[model samples]
Target: MENSAGCSVSLWQKIVSFLLVIFPILDIYSVGIKGIGIGSIILCFILIGMGIRFLTLNRSIKLNPYYGFFLYGLCISLLTVLIHNDFSITAVAIRMTYFLFYTLLIFLPSSYDFDIHFAEQIYLKIGMAAGAFLILQYFSFWGLRYNLIGLIPGLPLNYAIEDYVEWMDAYNNMYTIMFRPTSFFPEPAAFTQYMAPLLILVLFTNVGEKKKLLKAAFISIVMILSTSTNGIVFSLFIWILYFVYINHDSLKNRRFPIFLVPLFLFAIVFAILILFTDNTISDYTVQQFEGLFSKNQSSSAYLRIMRGFDIYRQLNFFENILGIGLGTYKSYYATGVLTVYDGETEYMNSLSYLFVSTGVIGVLLFIYSLFYNVPRRSMASHALAFLILLSFFSSSLFNSPTYALSYLFLLHLDSIKNSGD
Candidate 1:
């Protein structure tokens, strides 16, 4: 009976682990409350159950020191809120709650003995499922002239056909027929952001070469089909970096071979530009590529990458050192001290959000915690860390439970691999 109970508990842990892995995608559903999300509620329950189990077993929980430092940073943020007297205390409290939740989640996998390999398998399965849906979504929309979301009943997706149409219109102003498949996400960029790190793991890690190449090819095709400029650019960047890293030993013995990757990419782009003339999708892609360097304040690229710096520049010295306050971005936005685009209150860039909301000290502590357990000598560890950091620049992911879980899972995978090596 004891053995059977142990097996059941183990099964329960595995189920929780799987749920945590997909929590980012699960965040879309609303549980009939404002400021309360399904993912957060599920996480709260998981943690509470774990807490009860620990207490029952009389197990002493020893958290990582970084979590202590993170708590300290939150305290500092609280102090900053007190000092500012202009930000919302309630907002800071709410933000602290989520931050605490995320910190505990970072420690959950190790405490529960969640297998890193199992997590990787979950990621791949998610990629495959999303890719399949994306393909069907694309064909169903373009060929059948039907929005795929409409066909699915009771899914409660956060987006509607009008939202997709608006996104499609953004990509091509003159021709609105071009459809980008978001799969389960609210937007194409979100889908790509979620998939980017998984792409890196499958391509760069020592996962079976045959399976890795096939998976990478399929994912790359999916990202391309999604038509997110961020996805396409990130995919190209990583592939080039991977090629260089893989051939570094051979290239060290020779010269000039390192330049071939860029040349190859350039050739492909040039061929596409020439062959796909008069094509709406190709023209829209080219337009977005050019928009990446646009100085216009309203361009998506500018809003995502440069707006954070603009906001950061407006901070007074004290605010710069300690930030305005946690979760105070909306309050700060309401102040109208700085010009914002599209009336969107949330900052697009995570790094910028971290800096603007948490201040310099908070940023340092967070970065240190993020890299604390990562193996310094392992190339895979560095690659995963780099990809995680890169993903932050595209959106407000610093406080996201999904990104936090992904970061923890990847680091756990690296530690496991390093120990094995």
Candidate 2:
């Protein structure tokens, strides 16, 4: 009976842990009352429970060296409330809540027996399932082709009617009527950023050979079908970097002839695809390539750079150093401080958003935490770091639950090393 009870408890623990591992994907489509992802809503409760458990287990919270910098940044964000002459404490409180959760996750004691590799395996499987949906959608096989909009009560799921349909129409007008497979995400970019790391792991890691090859091909095709410029570029960069890294020793030892074989084959296949695949996908990629140099395109990288400078020039010395404050970009610009380009576009780059929201001090602190504080000795860690950096140019990193989870998971992995287990 004692043994049976122990087994039951263990099973429950595994089930809960697995749910936590897949929370990002599960919560991707779910939004809360405050417009936050359902996964983040669930995460708050999980953090609280874990915090209580830590206390019960008599585990002391050990502060990392960078903790002070993080808190200092948070305090600066809070100062925005006063700076704005708005007495509302909610904005500052929300920021505090997020960082607090982040800190707890970082400091909480981890189970020695917990298998991170197992968690990563489960994550990849979930990603593959999501990728399958994207593939079906790409071929117009009757999948979710509209923005998932609505509020699911008693759960943190909310969607809004926005530009998704209009954007699809524009794409149809520009290229073909084929829909970009967003899976369950709000947009193609979100889908790509969330899936990129998993796809990289499956393709490049020393996992099951047959399974990896199938997954790699599926994911690569899905990404191309999505036709997100940043997504395709990031995925391609990851593949090339992984190939070179794995073959570095061999190539350095004068195996250039052998090294060129795989490179040549990959180039040939890519060229053939560009030349002969359905014009929609190929043409879309070609357009993105051309847009790299064009200044008029909506998703122009050049426009992002120019806009960054424009926004910076608008800020006063005080505002530039300390930021206008969190959540004030729209209002700040609307108040005739400066005319923001495309008044409707959300933050184009995470790093730029950080500057706009938190100023230089905050960006420096984040950078330090990202690079100097984390343990990054392993190839896996380095790969994740590169993906995160690549993603910063395209999306808001901290706001996205999946990206936040990925970074937090890195901290968890780093904690294991710090524990010397």
Clash count of each predicted structure: 0, 4
Residues 64-84 of candidate 2 have per-residue lDDT tens digits of 655865676577666766676
Global lDDT of each candidate: 0.66, 0.58
Candidate 1's C-alpha runs over 4 A off are 1-9, 55-65, 84-86, 150-177, 249-278, 333-342, 415-421
In candidate 2, residue 82 scores what lDDT? Answer: 67
Q: List the residue pairs that clash in candidate 2.
A: 30-157, 31-156, 31-157, 31-158
When summed lDDT is taken over every stretch of 10 residues in candidate 2, the lowest stretch is 1-10
Residue pairs with backbone atoms closer than 3 Å in model 1 (clashes): none
Clashes of 1: 0
lDDT of candidate model 1 versus the reference: 0.66
Per-residue lDDT tens digits for candidate 1, residues 1-421, read 1121123235765667677778877766546455555777887887888777777777766766667656765776677667668878888888888777877777754535455556666778888899889888767766686666511234333333323345444434422565556787767777877777777767666433566656766776677666677777767766766666667655566666754644565456545434633366666666666667787665676678777877888888987888766777776677786666556556558888778876887678767776776666555566667666776676677757557766675566643342113
